[model samples]
Target: MKMMKNFRNEDGFSLIELLFSITVLSVGLLGIASTIPFGYKAIEQSAKRSTAASLLNEGLEKLKGYQYINLIESNFPDEVYGDIPDFPDFARTYEIRMASDVYSSPIPELKMVTITVFWRVSATNEQRIFAVTYIGQRR
Candidate 1:
């Protein structure tokens, strides 16, 4: 009696299997690549927002240092005023509005001041605005 030996076939992946795996991996990589631009845009927007907020804070601090009497009695200045002076180069394109008023509040003697900073996002006609408020006591 002759016995036949059973040998297991151990070859590399078949053509079909290899092609399918490459196709799937390529698709996944392409999908991830498509999102890169969007991620970059989000990061840019966040940076712009942070810079705008800082500028707004700087404007507020300038108001704080002014004579309390000037703050309470004077209307919001038509222009941006501060020791730091001008906006950083990045923010030069932004439009800023400053408003001051004496309103009927618990503190009638104090003035209510609002500072708003506005800018146009790149490629967008819409305006973005950031604002800060402070109350100043009559000197």
Candidate 2:
């Protein structure tokens, strides 16, 4: 009588090994899936910041385009041009403050102009601010 050969000794992964690999793969996939929403949120916040910066720059340009002679010695609210159109929607409110160096020199100059843009982001009612400064010359 010939003895039966042990054919069960094939070199391959067992059922337990296969199951463990599948479990690990599933966990990794789940971790990746969870991060997707967080990535989207980060992108949204970055966009809001970019919009605020653009709005501030727009305000600065508007101030620069005006007649330089009138701006050289003017003060806050007087030199500010609040009615300029096409402000970005992301900024809920914006303001400009102008300061002059009338006491310093023979030709008083625009010391500084500050532009502030404010906006809210997310459901928690958080706020972000963007500001820029510019100096103008006397025409």
Tens-digit lDDT string for candidate 2 (9-120): 5678999999999999999999999999999999988887887677767766766666755543233242122343453334433343344432344434544555566555
Q: What is the model-wide C-alpha lDDT for candidate 1?
A: 0.57
How close to the true structure is residue 136 of candidate 1, measured as C-alpha lDDT? 44
- Estimate the lDDT of model 2: 0.59
Name the candidate that leads on lDDT: 2
Clashing pairs in 1: none
What are the TM-scores, per candidate, against the unseen true structure? 0.67, 0.66
For every candidate in turn, the CA RMSD to the true structure comes to 5.8, 5.4
Clashes of each: 0, 0
TM-score of 2: 0.66
lDDT of 1 by residue, 3-119 (tens): 333223555788899999999999999999999999998998787677767877776777767775666424444443232355432331222222323334565454445556554
